[model samples]
Each structure stands twice: as C-alpha cells, then as structure tokens.
Target: MSQKKMLRFSTGALLLLLPWFGGLVLGEISNDFSQCLDFFYNTTPPVGITAAGYQPICQRYKNQYHFASLYNRQSRSPLYSAYVLSPADGKRPRSTWMFEPQLAFSRASSEMQRFQTPLDQNVIESQAVLEDYKNSNFTKGHLNPSQHQKTVEDRKATFTLTNIVPQKAGSNSGPWNGLESEVLNRFKAFCNGSMHVITGAMPYESEPRWINNRVSVPEYMWSAYCCPSYRSDLPEFLKPFFPTYAAVGRNDRNSGEEIVPVNAKAGASVRGYDVRRMSLEALEGILKQRLGMPITLFHGQCQ
Candidate 1:
C-alpha cells in the first residue's frame, strides 16, 4: 500500500474507534487545539517521555495540521516535537514566532489572538517569550524543522514558540542542521512510505540549565525516524538507517561526553556540538537512563 493510502486507513480506523476507545469526546472540547492529536497516526502519540507539568500540544495553524509537541511547563520549552516528513517545496516562510494560548489561559477561554501576544501573568514565567531570545547567545531552535514539511502553511506552522527550544548557534547551523538535511535527502530518495519523525531534548542530569532563567536549556538534542517501507537496495552506509534510525547531538560544549562525544574534527566553532547517529535501541537506552523510566518514542519500535 502507498504511504498516502496507509495514512488514510489509519485515520479512518481512529475515527471508527474514537467513540468506544475512551469516554473522551473528540470534537466536544471547547478548544480547537484539542483536536491536535487527530494529526497523529491512529491518533496515537508518543509515550513514556513526559514529566510532571508537561502538556501535550497538537500544533495547528490556519486550520491546517502541522505537528504535535510535548511541552514542559516548568522548563518552558518542548520536551519534543513530532511530525511527518513531506517532500520539500524549497520555499521557506519567515518566522512569525507565535505562542500557545492554551499554555496561558484555560483551553475554553484561550483566544486565537493570544497566540500573537505575550502573556503578562502566565503561571510559568519561564515560558519562552519572543523577547527572551532577543540578543541572547542561543538561537530559537526548531525541533520539527520547517524544511521537512512540504507546503508553505506546513512550514509556517512550525514557527510557533511552543515547538521551539534553546540551541547554540554552532549546533543549530552546523552539525544539527546537517543531520536534518541528511534525513530529508534520504527520505526523499529512498523512503517509498510515510516517515514519522520525533525530535526532542535531553536535559542535564544533576542541575538544570536555563536560558536567562526563563526557558530551560537542553544538554543535548536527539531525533529519531521510523520508515517502515523503503527500498530494500540501500547502500551499505544506509542499511542500518532504514526501518528506524536515531541520533543525539551535544547542546552544551562544556558538558561531559558520557552521552554524545564531541567530534574533534568538527572545527573549533562546532567541535563540541557534534551529532552521533545510532540505532533506535541505543537512543531508547539513553532516554531510559536519563528519564529514570522506560520511554518509547514509536509504536513497536516502528515495526
């Protein structure tokens, strides 16, 4: 079956099972944002990565589905953002940098206009406001990069602050960006099926780091992709990448290399922010150790 057809079938099955799956009504929630999970396959989101005060966000813009985010209220940043890859259209939209109203107000009372403005009395003052990133050393890094999506709208939908995290300039423009491009190129060339990608953050072990004491800074950034259908005749270098692959990139240069080791050849600018590619199982092992619990990013390891 084609990837498009498989997506349709999965969505249909979700709708059919929605009524009996849980007492929760799909569209009955007053907030339109509540329907965000409808974008996920079978309406099943990632599991085992959430922490206390973390909220799930189904990112929608202009009534179009974009991506899903697991946001940390305390950290005032996303734990991760999940989205499906689409063929690139070569048109990048300017970042509008919007906020999530539901993060500040009750879902029923949250207004669309709230997404455009900064909240004055938000419970989590650490919430990353646009002003916080201004003149700061770090860049507003995107977990679900705009380049992975196809349409203009899809690209723009990724601009919301809810889907962003603090990243160093070296990592954002260097090794990390290279990894995202590599994934896009591989999917466009070899994947004959849908690719579900989840990119996220790993916090420091003992003490938490902060960006201006507002948004929490991640110690490392990690990503994984699951492509169940692909050309069997992959090159030797690309063989282990099929079905599922994962990577972890250093976010802090001063941090220890017990997780992702720094690449000495990456140049002084990005030497410590090197990204390491590994298997799906290896990524999960790191997550399990850091989170103090077993966390699964994809269903059946994207079998």
Candidate 2:
C-alpha cells in the first residue's frame, strides 16, 4: 500500500477504538475506591484493616473533593476516614448530616448528597438512615471531624453518615472532643507540610454491638497522623510527637482497661472513657491484639 494510504488506515483504526477505551476508563473510575487515593499526599491509605464488606469513598460535597473514607457497608459506618489536615480558621461549619446515597441505592452514583427524608423505602431497609439515631443515647460522632477541615465546604463534607459512628454521649462530648481539639492545635503548630490523618473505630472482640441492630457501635475510637515533614527545631515536650503519633479513646465505660487504663483523675464526667495518647506502634499493637489480625495504619509505618 502507498505510505499515504497506510497513514489514513492507522488514523481510522485509532478513531474506531477511542469510544471503547473511554468506556473502559470510565468503568475503572466508577468501580474502585483506591482511585480516589490520589488525593492523599503520598497516595497512601491505611493497611491491615479487615477487607470484608469494605468500600472506599472519595468524599465530594457541592462538587468539590474533600477527603476519602474506607466505609463498611455491613456496619453502616466508616472503618476509617482519611484526609489531609488543612489550616483551620474561623468557626466550624454547621453539620449538614448527609448520607451516602450510592451506598444504599445501586443506581446512585458515588457523588454525595443530603439524605432524603421518607428515604426510598426499598433501599432504606439495607442501611442505617437518620431515623435510627432518633431517641438513641448514642450521639452521631464523626470519624473524620469537621474541625480538621479548612474551608466551609470541606468541613460540611465530613458530615456524611458514612463517616460517622454511634459514639457515646460522654465520649463524644467530653474526652474525645478534647483529644480532637488537641490534635488540631498540634497539627497547626508543628506540621510544616501536608498532614495525613486516619481516624477509625474498633469493635468488640467476641460480640458485635449495634444501634437499632442497624449500625455497628464501635467499642473504641482510634486516630493516627503522619506528618512526614515538620519543623526541625522542636521543643523537648513536643519531640516525641514528630513524624507520627496516635491515640485510642474509650467509647464504652463498661469495657475493660487492658488497652487504655481508666483515668481516676478525670472526675465523674469523663473518668471511664479516657483518651490515652501513645506511640504509633503501641496503638497498632493493641489493635492487632483485639482485632486478631495484623493491622498497619500507615505505609512503612509512616517511616
């Protein structure tokens, strides 16, 4: 064939394959949650958590990317919500209290929106809706808190139900809240670059706890952060906190103290459900013991 004829044939074949290739690319984007991890500073998500029923969510609100969460449909809550800590200023945004529509409805897209009242009765049965929290003692505690976000839109995106767990009133309002505030201040003061954070829950070892038998109630709440880059000049007190730090907060007063010792000094309000700060390795050790599985929260253990 002539050179001109050969070039024309090649161009025609390329055009014919474009639509099929586009469809393939779209299919991969729609199906996998790991695709969203590109938003992370190092494109690293936590490892070693149970994979069963795990769903990855790239949180978007008002058409803006906010964060990513590893959601558990079986528990109707997030296993962990990961986000980069931004410089927070001004008042925290009001909680919009959204639910993941795509989680409950197959036809629904991964994009997030507010939960509809009189939820489509068909899909409502499969997941926990807002009504489950009504009259319940547990508060809708955030796994990825709004305070860590910088912008109003980013803060509001954290309100999705997939990122919430059934947290106890005392833990949510008292010690846990204090821990979150402390973390925020630490990140603001020391972290000079991107701060990667993952906050999650731990369920009971032997038996599963539930709210309205719909959402699984976590026995303890845990969080960890990796600040790969930070100020080299460090105060003596803040030295141990560099690179990585972690904590495990008690969610149930009735639970034993093998992992986190109860604080006698905390007084009546927040005595039992105390938050214990520890080295990242210590927290991972406790998780491994209780979860009966080897779990790593950061890549190379954030080293």
Which residue pairs show backbone clashes in model 2?
none
Point out the worst 10-residue segment of candidate 2 by lDDT: 20-29
TM per model? 0.84, 0.86
**Compared with the true structure, what per-residue lDDT tens digits does model 2 show for residues 160-268?**
8888899998999999999899888888888888888889999988999898888989999999889888889889899899789999999999889998889887779
> What does candidate 1's lDDT look like per residue over 35-64, in tens digits?
566444445666674457777776756655
**Model 2, residue 11: C-alpha shift (Å):** 40
What range of 10 consecutive residues in model 1 has the weakest lDDT sum?
Answer: 23-32
C-alpha positional error of residue 117 in candidate 1 after TM-score superposition, expressed in Å: 5.9
lDDT of 2 at 138: 92
